[model samples]
Target: MILRRKENLSKVEQKHEKLKTSNMKWTTILLFLCFMGITMASAQQKTFKGTWLYEQGEKNGTIQLDLYQKSVENEFDMDGALCFGTFAFSDGSYYSIEEVEVEGNKASLQQVLDTEMGNFKMQMTYNSADQSIELSTNGANGLPDKLLLRKSDIQNQETSAESPIINEVDNETSSPINWTSIIGAVILIIAMAGYSLFIINKKNEFDQVYTTEYFSATRRSNGKSPQSSSEEDTQVTGLLDKLQHELTTFQNHTSGASYLVVLKKKQHKKCAGYLRQAIEIASTNPEILHDLQQYAHILANSQKRLFDGSYSVMIAAGIATLLVGYLMSDLLIVILFAGAIAVYYLASFAPQYLILNKVANSSHTSTGFLGTLANIVGNAKVITYIFDTQDTIDTITGDNIYRYDDYSQVQASVFIVILAYLVTGIGIMYIACWRFFRNFIMH
Candidate 1:
């Protein structure tokens, strides 16, 4: 009987140990599952992306926030795309959108939104408890309109729907064959070539006409005008005529077939300089001066027209190259080449635009300065001296300001170009590596 009791006690002890082990295993698994659940819940609690409408006093506006999912480690998805930022939630409110100032837990949003009545600012307050939002307007006073919005309301409704028609439409529209763009590119190339050729031929024709009309003219018929007295006058007129002929030839030669349009710019500048000199030399003679000014005006106008045309053509070409690159993505080399070309053109144009803007600002400042000086300076000698001194000082100061602004703009442009190059170069290199790896594995 003692041996049997001891055996029963041992058996009970073994059973209890087995039960304890099983309980521990289950407890560990349960804890692991709970941890996983908490992580998933945290991820899901992130902010949703959509249009947030808000109101200010007597005005309504809509703030559209496009959120991207975070792609890199240490980054969280703001909307669908990953971004390197953490979500901020405080005082019963959450802030997730970009470009809005958030203080504590409150966000201030001002935007112009289209409404049925026209455009208005729609002010909204978000409450996390009931997933409810309230909208009010300063226009509508303190009486706020309440809206109950669930998480589903901000979801991408289209993504949930299974509609073949919609999918087909999107596929067709988003990246269609772009035959129109192709045709336009071809037409543009042809038109540019034709225009350049026409300009060359027209300039040649004008030169011939001008030479024959001016050089072959019989000395002013006896009674009509006084004879040119100074030998210098005759010599100057002859030089002017020769210079014009040379300019016409230069324009025709340089502008006709060059891929680099800047050559044409240099020619235009030369023409302007010659015209200015001719006007200065012939200033005293009415008829001669009139003719010279008219000729100068013609040259100026032609230069402007050509400059504008060239700018348009270059822009079109850049766009065409980008489009072709996009369409012919299979040819990676060609795509890269096109991208480089587009970037080059962009860089060139950016500088030219900056120069033009600078010139315009300078002109405006000069005009304002002159106007102010004229208003302040009377006929008095002392006033005149003061005006001249001040004007000179202002000119120097204005030039310094312009130089600083230009330098800043140039620095900004350089930074932007560097950033673009880095991004594009990395992307291209990654694609190349990926392709190489894929090909090697396939083989």
Candidate 2:
């Protein structure tokens, strides 16, 4: 018995270890992505990249230099940018920008002239800030190897600058997803997710046993009785098969699947009840009656709570689902996380959502979903809608003071309340993950 318990403990430990790895890996990646975003947002293009009109031989020609293709989003170490831009002639002909390099305040641009475009001017179809516009031709030749666009050129020329760059397909992967420093957002998101986890732990702070004793229906839901002896025999045999299957699976479940066994045990009890009812009025052989009684007796007295389910897994998963779904700017990461969640639930066994929710949400039995539901809604409002808001707080507080030409004056600022909510939510997450295996994983 001790050896068996040791094996069970080992399996449980292994399971927990995997969960730990998954949680840590996910959190780390998200933090990294958030930091990358911040670095990129902060390293943003200097005040020098834009259109420059140069007068060469009395011809007024303008050049546009876009630096978005080569992003310094990685570590702000980017010096060379392979950007695409254009210079239009009065006749609607244009030069496509090949590469651009920024030094101090001067941006040096290069364009490999493609004569085959036949004066195909880039119109609404070219959006460099959103997508890279690459010009292609059988043979390329024309514009000078170097054209400089100075930052102080708007004095005599019209200039449109500060356009976001595009995805460049080259030696490196076109779309680079590094980290986040758009950090305020990422930290806020992580903090909110953490708090959700903490609150889930708080709300689910109870244990309750579940059983099929409440089932009122014993006969099959078809509402039709077996018309003949053979039909009755078939029904009896089927029920016996189902009961045996459920019982066998219940008994054979691993230590890791003890919670799933709870589900299976409930199923066995339900099967036993139905099997007994089926044999009640039927012309049952003595062997059948004896078999039904035995199984029912066994199921009636099965031991429980020998093991436990990780109560916070579902809550963690729910928080993870939201975190990955909304926090991750990368679509692939979101899809991967979402797919894992879907596949796990598709099995309909481990981490069973229904059972998990019953355990996690025992706090709201009296108040109904409204209790838990309102709590979750309030948390969301606090995390998202409450902070840095312009007017919702005022509307809620009834602070519509009539003054100063507009209601914004009355609305004023609600940032303090939002900041407090943000800090509280994040703090909860931090506390939930604190050591001693306290909140989320100890079970």
Model 2, position 276: C-alpha lDDT score: 53
Clashes of each: 21, 15
Point out the worst 10-residue segment of candidate 2 by lDDT: 203-212
C-alpha lDDT of residue 326 in model 1? 50
Question: Deviation in angstroms for 139 in model 2?
Answer: 12
- Please provide, for model 2 over 1-443, each residue's C-alpha lDDT reduced to its tens digit, 9 standing for 90 to 100: 45446546856985786576567545644564454456565466333335555444545556554443432221111453334555565555555545544333333344344335343222211223432222223232343333322232353132233322123423122112222322244453454345334323321111222222212121222233323256665677677667766653332223544322223435644665666555443523455555555655445333211212222333445455455445434554444344333322222222232344344446443443224434444444321222343444466676634332333322333444333343433233232233112222222
CA-lDDT, candidates in order: 0.35, 0.39
The best candidate in terms of lDDT: 2
TM-score of each: 0.23, 0.26
Candidate 1's clash total is: 21
The local distance difference test score of model 2 is: 0.39
